[model samples]
Target: METPERGLLARLDGFFFVLAGLAAVYLAYLTLREGITPGWPMLLVVVFWVLVSYLVLPRVHRILSRVYVPDYFIGRTRTADGLLGDPVNLALMGSPTQVHHALRAAGWTRADDLSLASGWRIVTSTLTRRSYPQAPVSPLFLFRRRQDFAYQQEVDGSPSQRHHVRFWACPDGWFLPGGLRVDWLAAGTYDRSVGLSLFTLQITHKIGADVDIERDHVVATVTAADGTATVRVLPDFFTGYHSRNGGGDLIETDGHLPIIDLSRVDVAGAPEAALPVVRIGRPVQTVVGSLMTSVRGIVYAALSSLALIGSRDADEVTAATSVLLALVLGLGALGDLVLAAATFAGHNWSRLLLCASSVLGVASVVAERLVGNLGGPLHEGLLPLATSVLVLLALSSDSAREYALGRRRRRPAPADQPS
Candidate 1:
């Protein structure tokens, strides 16, 4: 299959991605040193695990994967951490709505989109052995984003044991490796138990070794539910192989590929899982941007307070000028804090304000550089300047903008609703 070529903007995004990875490495090293210096052995070990698993190793994997992993349609899914995830062993030909309809008819429960609430719900429900029929699946990426949707079937009323599959809508004009046209691709796996990920040491579900069983199970259920739907197989679509998934569980699959034709399935109701995935929750850029804004505001507030305190007994002219400057700084700091909170709450206006403010800050630095007046930390383009630019880029990103827009569109004044 032909690989998609990334545009200039996409290349620019990769620069930022690599930069972030490097910065995370430095952060982890610094924290590890500090923790060790304190001589709290257990704390140091725990802190090291937290930093390494969540930050260091993922960044390392990302950098390495970009260099080695094939970017084309490889009939496999990738984890967020850039590890090769479950193999894609199934295909479908139908509109997303029809696909969802068939799956639901087959008695599959639509998995909840992964979010803070659903994530926590699954964790607690698993601990209590309570059935969470619609528990969210951890995200696995395809087509450069997470799965379009997922469905699951709980076994024996156990939250920990289930049959689940993640599906991705095929990109337009995209074809399978052998020139076969398909509308969607999927990875089906059975979660046997909860265990730690071997690659990253994170607690996650462990899958059964033989994934062919789950693939057959999905086919059986879908076709059994809808008489109109039919499936055909592609023999030896991939070389049959045994491998380990990202979570370190063994996975073996036959080379067969099943294409479920859902185009003929009847549909009469609003499709549930096929809706645009806008409600997957806030993007990471927005989260990071809000955090940086809040930190900047707090720093400004602290400095302004200190300045006012120190100027209390200064000479008359100095005291008056200092107090006025402090008050102005204090007001600006308060605005920053408010904007940060509103941005986190998914307010587009607040995001714009933050982005605009960062633009001005960047512009001022450029202006000073042009006049040869830049010096000190800003002169060296140090952390403060870098932070401003990052905040600007993140708040102005497409993901952040789309998320803010989606949130606003979903929420409307109560009076505007049908009474």
Candidate 2:
């Protein structure tokens, strides 16, 4: 029999990535149109700020960050936007089950996974000052994957304030800088209050200035769990330094690291058979790129449909030519849509096909502009060119390449014998 389905959603955030850029441009165009209007311009500017900050800036940062940001271990976590997020001040050497049991015993609650429902719930809870003990924490990346899980302690029934720690399982044969192998790595921080993210101007929780305090707080909590957990402090794992995290909040740490030994901790409910499941998902760039390809397909289909519809009044030869062109373009558009769907489903071949076509599309447009002396860097019909560029960039992104290759490598093996 076939294995049970993971039933994973093919979430191609790349579609949203391109949409954000398009929205930003549209908002800017609207702002220009209302430039002479007094109050409306200001309102539109704010709207633009909200959209650009949350959507466009993050993706832009992710693109640019690939150039300068080193992917090697830096004893820190990177934000979703690829900025240095939080310091890695804590480590662990225990099974995930023990860690879970120990943290719960120490009065920490495992946070809810981030989703549309949880996101809305947290927003409402924050606005109403309601206590949501299991509120989801924002993701941070280590080893190129978001934290496996996070735990938090809400302070005083307020969503704005909390003590949270995110954990990631250490890869095979990986260890600390000084050759100390650990089962997991963790970063802990205290959310003092909510404020705007300085880097992107998005609303976020401003962390406390000193992270050492939070690190110690985390170690203390776990050690206080009825003599179950023990701590071994690695002094000066990272040199004492002052720096700002991705959100641009002032943060200072003494460089001391704590390795919490949860091996001796108490019982858990069941075996953690699901902890090692394949974690393949559509990357932001790949999804956006694929969607952009679909947009091109839609455009082609629409143009062909219009051509067929308007060809009625033309002479015999003209009508026949129009019908032929329309049919050819329509079939090509249908194929493009199929390719996009396959790409979004994590097929490497489809992803590569989109990339190849996007390259040709962008090159052809630029070549036409240059050959025709169009008096601009690019020719007219900038929207078409822009979509092609987006499809090129998003699909060509490092995340997209990694996602495609990872998915390919992790695919199930074919059976030699039929069931």
Where does model 1 exceed 4 Å of error? 1-16, 37-45, 268-282, 313-419
Against the reference, the lDDT scores of all candidates come to 0.80, 0.78
Residue-pair clashes per prediction, in order, are 0, 4
**C-alpha-based local distance difference test score of model 2:** 0.78
Cα deviation of 265 in candidate 1 (Å)? 3.1
Q: With candidate 2 superimposed using the best TM-score fit, by how many Å does residue 81's alpha carbon deviate from the native?
A: 3.0
RMSD per prediction, one decimal?
A: 8.1, 7.0
Clashing pairs in 2: 14-287, 14-288, 15-287, 15-288
Top candidate when judged by lDDT against the true structure: 1
True lDDT of residue 48, candidate 1: 60
TM-score of 1: 0.72
In terms of lDDT, the poorest run of 10 residues in model 1 is 374-383
